[model samples]
Each structure stands twice: as structure tokens, then as C-alpha cells.
Target: MDQRWEDAVFLHWRIPVPAAAARMPPGVRPDVVDGSAWVGLVGFRMHRIRLGAAVPLPWLGSFPEINVRLYSREPDGTRGVVFLSLDAPRLAVVLGARAAGLPYVWSQCRAVGPGRSDPGVGYDVRRRGGRTTSAFAVRPDPTVRADDELSVELTARFGLHSRFAGRTVHVPVSHEAWTLHPATVTHVVDGLVAAAGIDVEGPPASVLYSSGVRTRIGRPRTVRGT
Candidate 1:
């Protein structure tokens, strides 16, 4: 599958390694840096979701999405993300992703801003059940630089660990190196993390933004330990 993510804002919080490890599935442990692990709440607008060489379908091709993610590492040094929940406005996408063992949920979402060329953007997500919700606005610095240690640590993930058909699996992903801008969280109100059983206090440890990335996600392979 091929997809483009645009006007993305990444909000990451430093949490105890054990706090993140306790939620990971079998075969993967928390991928910690400096004795701490990170969890991220990322929001973006998806575009050009295409299958094979097919043209991008209208509604299916575009939507707003938010995901709750954690860092993880396998025994052999492979690093990846573990998604706790993916909230999207498209029901078909929600259903399809869940069929593949992703924790996708139907939600009402909106993404607005001056656009990619602008320095700020806002996102809002409210799950269908109305129990889970998130809202935030980001304003990125004008200067763009290659990611620093903390930025790279959070965004350079190459794969994801998930359960499919009752088996732990890894799905590889590839994308161009991200050029990030330091950003500020202008405002925030969230329950997405708590909904995932993660406890985060105060504000995020890091806030970053990028125009976005074109990503290609590979097929899943069963984990060796599973």
C-alpha cells in the first residue's frame, strides 16, 4: 500500500520504560533511550491511499487520523512502534485495519490550518463512542533541520509490532528521512493516551512537525519468539 501523510504534528511524552514495556505484546520489549521510553500521539491528514497502481479513490483516499504509539525493540535489535489505537473518520478504513489486527477505531476527526506551507496546524479527534477524544494545535519554527537525537528517536521507526490472527507479527515500513522543525503545543486536551492505559502527566516531552512523508508499509511476518 502507498500513502501520503500531510501536515503532521508529533507529540511525545517521556514515560518509564517499564510503563511502556508492560503494555507491549510478547516478543518485543520497550525500546528505551537514556533509561526512558516514549509514547506519541500523532495527527495528520492522509492522502493518495492507493492499492498497487490503482488511482486514489476519493473518500477512501483521504481522511484525518490520529494514532497512539509506543516504541519497541525485538531481541535482535530491530526497532518498531506498537500502536495502541488508531482513530480515523472513515469506517471502511477502520474496519479494514482492524481485520488486519490493528487497533483501528471509527471516529470523527478534523484537520485544519493554512496548510503545508503554513507553520501551524490543528487537529481534533473524537471517537464514535464519544469516550475517547483529543484536540491540539501546533506551531512549528520556521527553520527546518535534520532531526536531532530526540526527534530521530521518536520518528525514525522502521516497522511496527502487532498481533494478527492471534500471532505476534512485525510489519516493515520505509520512508524518506524526515526533516523536522521544533514545534510548540499551542493547546491540548486529550484522553487518547489514558484510553490506551498509559499514564502521562503534564505536557509532552517533545513536540515536532514535518510537512509529511510518503510511506510504504510491507507485509507482516510472524515474530521469531512468538
Candidate 2:
């Protein structure tokens, strides 16, 4: 699969290792750094989705998305993301991803902008016929680059670990390093984290923003066992 991820707002909270590890698949564990594990609530626009060598689905493929995710690492230190939930507005995309074990929820989602009233970029997500929702915005400071260790660790992941047909599968992805800027939270109202079964107090520990990246996700392969 190939697609473009644009105008991403990355909000992350640090959590105990145990709390994150408990959510990992059997053979994978929480990826810990800076003495803790981190969970991210990321919002962005998904554009130009295309199957291998196929034309991009311009309309059906483009939509706003927000995902709650945790980091995972195998015994041999293969790092990846483990999504707890993905909120997208398109029902067709939701159904297709769920069939492959991605926890995609159909929702009313949209991307907001750096307009006159609100000079920050953000996203909004609300579950279909329900109350679960999340809204957040960030002001990226272009003067400073987000090239620190923790930033790279969170944004430069190359794959994901997921469950499919009772087995844990690893799907690799290829993408150039993201161009990130340190950011500050401008506004936020969230419930997606709670819906994802994670609890954290106060505001996000780290906030960053990026214009976007083009990604290519590879085929899934089973882990060594289970």
C-alpha cells in the first residue's frame, strides 16, 4: 500500500512500561525509552491511497484520520507501532482495514487549519452514531527542528505489529525521515485515549508537527512463533 500522510499533529504521553507492554501481542513487548513507554494520539490527512502499482483512489482514499498507538519491539529489537484504534470517516476504508485486523472505526472526521480564528493545525474525530471523539491542534515552531532522540524514536518507525487470524503479524513500511518541528498544543478535547483503554493525566508530554510524508507499507509476515 502507498499513501501520503499530511499535516500531522503528534501528541504523546508517557506511560509505565507495564501498562504498555500488557497491550502488546504475545511475542512483542513495549518499546521503552527515556525510562518509560509512550502512547501517541496522532491526527493527519491520508491522501492518494494506492494498491501496488495501481492508480490512487483520489476521492475514497483521501480522509482525515486519528490513531491511538503504542510502540512495540520484538525480542531482537525490531521496533514498530501497535495501533489500538484508528478513526476514519470512510466506511469502505474502515470495513476493509478491519478485515485485516486493523481496528479501524468509521467516524465523522475532518482536518482543521491555520485560519484566522485558529492559527494552528489540527483534526476532529467522532465515532458514527456515538460520542467517542477527539479534537486537537498544534502550532509548529519551524525555527527549531525536531531531531532529538525521542522525537526520532517516535516518528521514524518503519513498521507495525498487529494480530491477524489469531497470529501476530509484522508489516514493514518504508518512508523517508519525517521533517518535524517542535510544537505546542493550542487546544485539545479528547476521549479516544480512554476509548483505547489508556489513562494519562495532564497534557501530552511531547508535541510535534510535520507537513507529511509518503509511505509504502509492505507485506505482512508472521512472527517467529505464536
Candidate 3:
């Protein structure tokens, strides 16, 4: 797969190791960083999504996406992300991803006010059943760069762990180093994370933004034992 993840907003909170690990697939555990586990609420626009090196699909290719994700690593040190939920507007995309074992939910997702210069970038996601939603905004400070350990750990995943058929699989993703900007949560009301079975209180612990990046998603390989 080929795609551009644009106008990305990442919000994370430190959680208990057990809390992050509880939803992981077989043979994978919560990847600990800074002495604890962490979960992320990542909202981004997936622009010009194409399969392999092909041209981007027409309208179905571009859409807004929100993910509730956790860090994971196998015992042999293959690190990846574990997505508890992925909300997007495209029904085709949702069905395809779910068929491949990803937890993608069909939803109506869009930007709150991307063109304006005031509140910066944001996304609003409402799932199909109208039971789950996330509306949030942020202001990216271009002057400051977020190069700390937690930010890198949360944003630099190169693959994902998912369950397909009767086995766990690892889907590799490759992208350049993210150009992350220090961002402040101007306003937010989120429930996508909680809907996936984790509880996060107050504001996010780490907030970062990026213009975007192009990516290559690789083949899915079974995790050998599991």
C-alpha cells in the first residue's frame, strides 16, 4: 500500500502496562518506554491512498482517519503498533481493512476547521452507530520540535500486529522519520480510545503534530508460533 498521512495530530497518555497489554494479540506484549506503557489517539488525513505503486484511487482513496493504538513488541524485539479501533468514512476501506483483520470501523470523519489559521488542525469522528465519537483540535508550534523519547516512541512505529484467520500477523510499514512539531491541545472531547476498552482522563500527556509523510505498507507475515 502507498499513502500520504497528512495533517497528523498525535495525542498520547501513559497507561499501566497491563492496560496496554490487555488487548494485544498472541506473542505480543505492550512495548514499555520511559518505565510505562502508553496509548495514543492519532487523527490524520490519509491522502492519495493507492495499492502498491499504482495511482491513487479516485474518491475512495482520500479520507480522514482516527486510530486508538498501543505499542507492542514480540519477545524477539519486533516492534509494532496494535490498533484497537480505526474510524474512517469510506465504507470500502473499512470493509477491506476489516477483512484483512484490522479493526477498522466505518464512520463519518472530517476536519473541524483545517483551512483557518486560528485553532490549527483537527478531526471529528463519529462512528456508524452514533455511539462513539471524537472531536478535537490543536495548535502546532512550528518554532519548537518534539524530539523527546516519548514522542519518538509513539510516532515511529514501522509495522502493526493484527489477528487474521487463526493466527497473528505482522504487517510492515515503512516511512521516513516524522517531522514532529510541538503542539498544544487547544480543545478536545474524545471517546474513541475509551470505546476500545481503555480509560484516559484529563488532557493528553504528549501532543505532537506533523505536516505528513508518504508511506509504504508491506506484506503481512504470520508471527511463526502464534
Candidate 4:
């Protein structure tokens, strides 16, 4: 049995739409770009255990993508964190951008801590386009373990100019939880697209699957209207 209790940490960051478009790696596919044309930042941390090692290793990476839509409904102008899988880095970026109300090309600072103590690693996102954007730091949260599962927490501190200013929401989001893996991520994203009333072809309207404890939602349907 793979005794590795891996934890994936994700942070949401916001930036301007034009800046986000600029960050696109040339030839941005049409399907990847949402009609809304929003942009946001997503930071990912993959925590895994090295073979025969006592401690878990962390790999850091980030991607910028457009946010299509959010699942939960909140009061107008109310801020809250939405949990999502790390499978689609680009999707996460887009979602974050939409949530922050900024353009796509913006980048943000990221930091990783050294164990449970010490300040942690810090860095800022600089606009490569001759514009001087302010920098900020993020603090890492302690690790919490529950039986075979473990989770880590963190908070992102953005500059005052950030779109998320005056509103800070922290949510505990888990990525690709075991059995849910890649298939689960696909199912959820597809469901979201359908629920938004977007027209998509093929696939049934509902799907059912067992994941250890109980059956969960895994349906894919074609939307009638775009």
C-alpha cells in the first residue's frame, strides 16, 4: 500500500484582464478562453512522500487561467473561498481571475515555509511589461492530520490595489482526493459547464459512482442554450 499522505495546497490571486491576456503563452486556444474574458492566478503545492523518506516533499508551481463561474451562491459583494481540485491548473486560474474581477495576465507572489517553524519562502509577481506593480508576501499555515488524511493551510496577503481588497475569504479545499482523482475533476467541471446553461454535446445528464464511503455526483450533460 502506498502509505503516502499527500496534500495539495492552492492559493487564489487576482490580476487585471489585459495583464492576464499578456501572460498567455502566445496562440492561446479559443476554447480555453471564456467568453467573459476574466483572468486570475492559481498557486499549487504538491506534497508527497519520498520513497523510504520520513518527511513529505513539496513541489510548487502556478498557472494563469480564466474563471468560468462559481458554484456557490452568495449575497451580492459577499466574499468566500470556493474549493476546487488542482487537476486543471488553467481552469483554476480562469476561475480565480473571474472571482477577483481582474484581467488574466497578472502574476502574484508565493511563499513556502520550512517545516512547522521559521518564516517561510517568499517572492513577488513582477509584471514583465515595464509596469511597476506592488509586491506582497503570503504566510504558511500549520499542518493538520486526520487519520490517513492530512491537510495544510495558508493565507495570501495581496497589495491594496488587488481586486480582492477589503474582502478576504479562506476555504479548506482538497485536491484530487484519491478515488476522485482525474475522473472526478472532469465530472465536476463538466457539470459546472452544464449547470451554467452552456450548450455541450454528448454524455448523459447524471452519473453515479462509489467512493469508499458513499455514492457521489458525477453527471455530464449537454446544455440546451449557450
Clash count for each candidate, listed in order shown: 0, 0, 0, 15
lDDT of each: 0.88, 0.92, 0.90, 0.26
Query: For model 4, how does the per-residue alpha-carbon lDDT over 101-202 read when each residue is reduced to its tens digit?
Result: 443443332333323564332223333352423222233333422222111111211111112333323222222333311111121112222222333444
Clashing pairs in 2: none
**Candidate 3: how large is its RMSD?**
1.2
Put down candidate 1 lDDT per residue, 1-226, tens digits, no spaces.
7788888889999998889988898999999975689899999899988774366667686788999999989999999999999989898998899999999988899997946576578789888778878899889885767468878888988899998877889999888977788888889999999999999999998998888999887888999969
Models ranked on lDDT: 2, 3, 1, 4
Top lDDT model: 2
Which residue runs does candidate 1 get wrong by more than 4 Å?
53-55, 115-118
Q: lDDT of candidate 1 vs native?
A: 0.88
Taking the tens digit of each residue's C-alpha lDDT, what string does model 3 give over 8-37?
Answer: 999999899998878999989999988989
C-alpha-based local distance difference test score of model 3: 0.90
TM per model? 0.95, 0.96, 0.96, 0.25
lDDT of 1 at 207: 92
